[model samples]
Target: MILRTEIATILKAPPIGETVTVMGWVRAWRGNRFMVLNDGSSAETLQVVVDGEQFDEETIRGIGFHAAVSVTGELVESQGAGQAVEVIAKELTILGKTDLSTYPLQPKRQTMEFLRENGQFRMRTNTFSSVFRLRHAVAFAINKYFNDRGFYYLHTPIITGNDAEGAGEMFRVTTFEPDSAPRDEAGAVDYGQDFFGKGTHLTVSGQLQAEIGALALGKVYTFGPTFRAENSNTSRHLAEFWMIEPEIAFADIDNDMDLAEDFCKYLITYCLENYLSDLEYLDARIVEAEKNLPKDKRRPMGLLEMLRFVVEDDFARITYTEAIDLIMRSKPYKKGRFEFPVSWGVDLQAEHERWLVEKHFKKPVIVRDYPKDIKAFYMRLNDDDKTVAAMDVLFPYIGEVIGGSQREEREDVLRQRMQEMGVHEEELAWYLQLRTFGGAPHAGFGLGFERMVQFITGMGNIRDVIPFPRAPRLADF
Candidate 1:
């Protein structure tokens, strides 16, 4: 088989007289005769120009957008206005045709809502092609960041026995009807008939599983899907989201913070280097019309440089108590009550995070040493007793992209902490076993992947960046 390379690769090469084959989807028609075709190769649309002699409009009529085609012709170099050179086709074959009327991905612009409805077809469009391609680059960079650091990638169970965070943040599952389930003599429903022995739910965090592995393997990380039952209808919150968690044994609070910052910088840099061209193509063609959207509205910068800046600079850290003091001193809103009230001990709200990152610090800020009452019980208690060694990395556009902590490693301390925190002792004996054993001190962090995509792409709504975003009241794809 005489194989042919992509049309874009041969654009500036020696194709003047040699006949070569190029396969791609018809992206558009320019002038009265020439047509552009793509192979879904990269973020770019490879151009194939046609001269009316052997490749007349009547020769290939009514071949609508996204129609698959093959052009066998000489690759020539020229100073044509529309496309660089041209494909003076020896033969043009329309392999697959689409109806122009309802193809959904025409040359004209479509709304994000409209494109979302055609998510399956939207990838064929230039916009989603770039978004998803960049998404792939970032994900690869995320894993490579940890793997290069001698960290083992641990596959945590999706069906969890216990929720990592004691916030009742899990989606309960059952084979039987939920409402009419059988009960025990004590009126509490017996869960033997449930899916996973006692009861099971989608995991809210992989921190616990990562903990088990980290204690044994010494250093570990988990990149997997997580679920939260919280009825959040905001752009930043998702019922099902991807989380990246790295756990290390014998690591202190400071060590965990260092890892968190380095990991972020590594991911950003990796994507920027590998996917800068793809992003530019995606931005120019597919999303050019949609730049008016808040997320796409930001001044464009090279993805590679942005990533380098993230890793190259020192990230600022401020304690939750200090952050609250700053907010109080500045007084974000001059008068009225806050929608999500805040104080020294309160959990930081999205608005509060936005204010701190967007207005106050104006950089990637890690708000650390959170109030214990508002954080997970697994966090190490600070010397002051009121706060814990927990941190949340907040950025300008995306509020809280990461949450981390130095875990409670002491057996007696952990047991007492669990009980005092009102977490069920019976449901967590397995987790407690790690503490009972060699259990050296360990710490880890969980980064919301979708939120990171939203941050990187500057896409306002989380839905657009994800392939098929799963959020409350919006599961359409």
Candidate 2:
């Protein structure tokens, strides 16, 4: 039996003169002698040199771009200038032949839009592969960062009855026919006949359930898929995406802030050290992509520099009021250049967040103590009765990367807040009971995993980072 070797491993430590079997799709072929093969193992490709005279003529002719092939080769030091090692093909077998005439991907530059249209096959591209590799590294780093700190990886439910964010953007799950479901006395659609015996939806966030895990297990984190049904067609919004939510028991808002900052820094540092090659490639891509943009729109720091800065520098910590004051006094707002209104009570828009992180701070900023009305009801109420102990970690290009708060532990306060926010107290009885019992001060935050990848990979569109993005009217395979 022949041993299969990945292209990455062969390229890393080429076993000179050792026979190995390499299997992957052909990326490119030149003069039927040199073929670049990629197996999605690493961002790099293996240069397979074949002797056509020794191999079957049909096999040599079958080799084409995107054709899956098995190449039995001897690893040898490369004579080529671009790579260090190349494989000398002893025998070649075409496993799958892809017709280039109908293939969506070509051996040329492709726009993000075109790549997204062919998302089913986009992972084969160097850019998407690099982005996904970095994404994997970031996720692994997240688990390691938590696991090293004695945090249990919790798997929360994907479907739930509670509106975690109270945003009312949940995707409804029902068994009844739409517009033809049984109606009650009030002429409202009867939910009792539904599959779950009540209204259910795809979860918006796992933080609420993660709190249960934290209460029972002390510290827990959830990395899972979440859904939102908002019809947003932007570079940032996604109908479905993964979220990393960590809940810590007996921790206050300050502790949450500390944990959030440390977590962000750890992820950035992990990628910088582990995925530097992919990062370097992405950095160059970002620089080249921004070259056509306006002078003022281009980022001041490259991808690696930005990641290093996040790891080295401390995140600027400020209160929401402080940020509002800065925004109001800034040139954009003063000169009426800001598109969104920047009042003290109004929620911070993307424009306001960018100015705070990109222009004013020039670093990641953790803005806490937002106005109570503008934030979720579960956030702990401050003594002033005006603001909640909520925090948002804003990034340079991405506005809000993480959002969390110190949950209200007191049953009376929690119930009152729920009532004021029009959340049904009966439906969340189990959740509210946590406060009724020995509910200690708990804090947690939800980090948009896709957005983090976007920031890390220097990719502008959120759709490019996720494997298959679910967005408004765009669920292409």
Candidate 3:
């Protein structure tokens, strides 16, 4: 049997008269003459010319949309316009014939929601294939970016006893029967009798554990799945998502912000340089998607334009205080356009952040020194005692892409912050000991992998960026 060449490879360098075997699903079988095939290798598909007279009735009958097939043919320059080369099929074998009457997908345009419901076949579509390809590109760029910078990739535990964010929203990890489990004297479920001998839940973030690695290894990162049990079913929220967190020792808030900006630009630039085809497809996808929307509702720039602008421009940096002041002084706030109320101590909502990035700065913005009360317990306390040395990197479409802080390394201060935030010190004794033993000033931030993908791909929903999305009342394959 002859080896099969990938459509992507053949398309990249066409051997004008060489015979090659290609295997892929039929994207389209037009008038029983031309078979468009794609093997998920690249966004482009290949045209295989089939002579109805040369093929028997059975072989011709087997060819249809999405039917798996292998073609042994002579490669030649195309007489067509869209593609440069074509395959003249000398032999055709049906690998798997699809019964189109029952198949969920069609060649025509389908709604995203409908496509999402049929996720098993969604990748076969152009939009999703491009999305997942760029998704892979971004993942590769993430590891490459960190590895090139001398950062080790650390795998944090998925089932963790510690809630790094102290948000009390976590998916419980238990082997016990939920309705009939051991109970303590207080009538609470006896977590001590459970799998790990105590309460444990899916980790919300890997920043805390990555800090340990950073303390020992100088620089480390964790890129893995993190879960949250929050009931939000919005476009931006996901029950399970991947996080890329990098922790660096001896780094303060300034260093953290600089790293965040540089790292983001690098990811975008890498995609632009290497995966322009996929990006171009997604870019055109957005342009076609937003054609009907009102002028103000549409994006200010096209996807490629926006991505290049982000990579070329410098991110604006300001304190949370300055951000708040700017928002308050903006015309929208003056006209009471925002739905969420903005105040000094309260957390900044997405609307507020969007205003700062999209309307005010006209570029990516990093807002630092958020009020201590609105931040996590581990963030370093500023000298003013009112704010923490924290920062959030905001982009045009996605409000916050990265959030990080210079950790509170002072053992006493961490203890006080824990108590103030209602987190039990006994539960994190080892965490405190890290500070007591050899903890240096460390900083790290987490980039929501799906959010960055969504931003880069111009995907409207966070769920669409991930292959299998987990959301409220959603766990479909």
Most lDDT-accurate candidate: 3
Misplaced by over 4 Å in model 3 are none
Once model 2 is optimally superposed onto the true structure by TM-score, how far is the C-alpha of residue 5 displaced, in angstroms? 0.8
Candidate 3, residue 208: Cα displacement in angstroms equals 1.0
lDDT of each: 0.77, 0.89, 0.92
List model 3 lDDT by residue over 1-477, tens digit each. Answer: 658999889977888999999999898876778899998998889999999899987788778788999999999998977789999999999999888788988779999899989999999888899999999999999999999999999999999999998889999999999789999999999999998999899999988899999999999999999999999989999999999999999999999999999999999999999888888998888888899999988887899988987898899999999998988888999999999887799888888988888788888899999999999999999999999999999888778999999999999999999999999999899899999999899999999999999999998889999999999889986
Best candidate according to TM-score? 3
TM-score, prediction 2: 0.95
- List candidate 2 stretches off by more than 4 Å: 30-32, 55-61
- In candidate 1, clashing pairs total 4
Q: Estimate each model's TM-score.
A: 0.90, 0.95, 0.97
Instruction: State how far residue 347 of model 1 sits from its true place (Å).
Output: 2.2
Better candidate number, 1 or 3, judged by lDDT:
3
Per-residue C-alpha lDDT of model 1 across residues 1-477, encoded as one tens digit per residue = 847678557753645767888888887887656777777666655556676766556657756778888888877765566556677777778788898777667788788788878788888877677778778877888777888888899999898778788778678877768688878899887888676778888888888888988988899998998988877887667788899999999998889888888778777766666667665664454345555668645533433334444566677899988888877766655454347766777787877787776667766789899988888889988888788999988766457878899998877777878888998878888888888878788899988888787666656678788887777776764
| Worst lDDT 10-window in candidate 1 | 299-308
Clashing pairs in 1: 15-75, 24-38, 127-286, 295-458
Q: Cα-based RMSD of the predictions, in order?
A: 3.1, 1.9, 1.3
Task: Report the candidate with higher TM-score, 1 versus 3.
Answer: 3
Output candidate 2 Cα RMSD.
Answer: 1.9
Give one digit per residue, the lDDT tens place, for model 2 in 140-234: 99999999999999999998999988989899999898868999999998899888899999999888889999999999999999999999999
